[model samples]
Target: MTLNDLSPILLDAAAPMINPRDVDKRLPDMIAGGLDAVLATAGAIEDFRTTMEDVAKWLEIERSGARKIKIARSVADIREAKASGKIAIVLHFQGSDAIEDELDFINVFHACGLRVMQLTYNARNRVGDGCFEITDGGLSKFGRKVIRRMEALSMAVDLAHAGPRTALEATEVASRPMIISHANARALMETPRNVSDDLIRAVAASGGVVGVCAAPFFLTKDGPATLDMLIDHAVYIADLVGPQHVGLGFDFAEENEEDYVYFGYDERYIPMPPWTFPSRIASHAEAGNLESSLRTRGFGEAEIRGVLGENFLRVFEEIWGC
Candidate 1:
């Protein structure tokens, strides 16, 4: 294959419009946007049966097509997808609610190609408290067990939407490095969803990565959520723990935002609608804008590559071991 034919494996840490059926329609956009693989949300806060159904959708997608999109369980699989011009799909979770008291189900999900799992969504669960939880009780005993099991099974844990107490505890308690899969620096913008520098450093010290999200609210309030605003978050984290600890999770939703479902708190039960939650990243095609942003900020090619995907790729290799 020619050099241009086999580009670098550009992975978006948190991509949306990610349903199995919907991915077929988005494949052309992903290719045009220069994304080689994306860690897509497969199940979040759904029941076990619902979770299995979610995974089955991807399985069916892979079985139906030899080329369009496929499941990727390893770094090698992601590389293969890049070489062949296919968007590798890494099934991940935004919360652990789907397992529902089933610790052993971690293994089941892992075997089914689930490579990442978050402890909580936006409220408390069996695993831990989410960012929106008023009580912020933190990680439970079962939550610790879940982290241990995930480490043993090579299923990486995410703390992106976790509460402050839970995020701190996960960083300290995890035997393996855990990721804040998609969040920005709260130092840049004051929001509950934005991560603090303390948590960012803790994640880097734990041998983990922090993926900066480009959501509007997370970026800044001074002006429009431009690519510069996104890099500011990356620069902040990179300044703290070095570029090796920084990465991109854009969290861009291209197709249907309605594909994501939550089980923590009902919108009617809650005071506000979570759908109104900030999603400032304009489009998945904006994925190509990141390289120039990094360069403008004086990031070298290697550093930019790390923030792009190599840094995340390193963490996956350490966890997956293949």
Candidate 2:
């Protein structure tokens, strides 16, 4: 089955020393790892000018390597990319800070090929409160306007890092499908970054899909995590919302201790070095192990396909309308 990761960090966030715009650097590895398409994270908590530069850099990379990477603006683009044996790169954001208080910039970025966007990163923003906020303010007036505009413009609204009230409020306001693009079940892991059952039910009730994250810290707090732990989250969501609303969103990244330190994640939430993922699915190249694990856990073929990519594709079609 084809795979689509809703939130793959294509660039090594920890290593700016390397060429950040060399988007195709992991192309061969992803292909070997069984990924057909990815909603490549393009910007997060960046200001307007910086985010625009990031988008321009991504476009330049696609232009220079058209044969290997296609900038997907619609479901048709993804389909064509798959047919042509090219990897689809749907530009995505992990926060709406880049748009700031200016709503018109949403149209500007949409024109530039950004298909998915999250409302907040991990704290309060102009849009709303992120998961890390001590007091959840929910979606602000500006945030509601942003969601309406995004729906009208055919862009996917993501709630990955949104606080409980923020996520619930956004779902209440959203007429079309919304997504928690990359989060795990809080019931299992007990982390604020993970979604609560209330949030998951609300999202799925609104016809949205939830992508299970693959970070070891979010999967388990004990020793090294195994692929079974990752599948456990997928199984929980699938059982809660059915297979059609479950998908993968491996927020994979190359990192060092300093990266998380600089990002200000709580020490307990940060896994100690050496930062190794589940051995069977260590890197993007080993993602196929997730499928094997799912099968071993008794998920049938159609359900497996949905978890792999179809669920996200269906939401993309319903929201993007292409």
- Model 1, position 245, has a per-residue lDDT of 94
RMSD of each: 3.4, 4.1
* Stretches of model 1 off by over 4 angstroms after superposition: 1-6, 254-281
307 in model 2: Cα distance from truth in Å? 0.5
TM-score, cand. 2: 0.91
- Candidate 1 structure, TM-score to reference: 0.91
Pick out the ten consecutive residues of candidate 2 with the lowest summed lDDT. Answer: 9-18
Q: Estimated TM-score per prediction?
A: 0.91, 0.91
Residue 249 deviation, candidate 2, in Å? Answer: 0.4
Candidate 1 residue lDDT tens string, 1-322: 6533454567888875677767767777677778888999887778788989989888877887855676999988888777766788999988898889989998898988999988988878888888878898988999989888999998888998899999999888887787988999888888778888889988998899999887665676555567777888889898889999988897765323243233444333232223222322466665777787799898998898888888898899889886
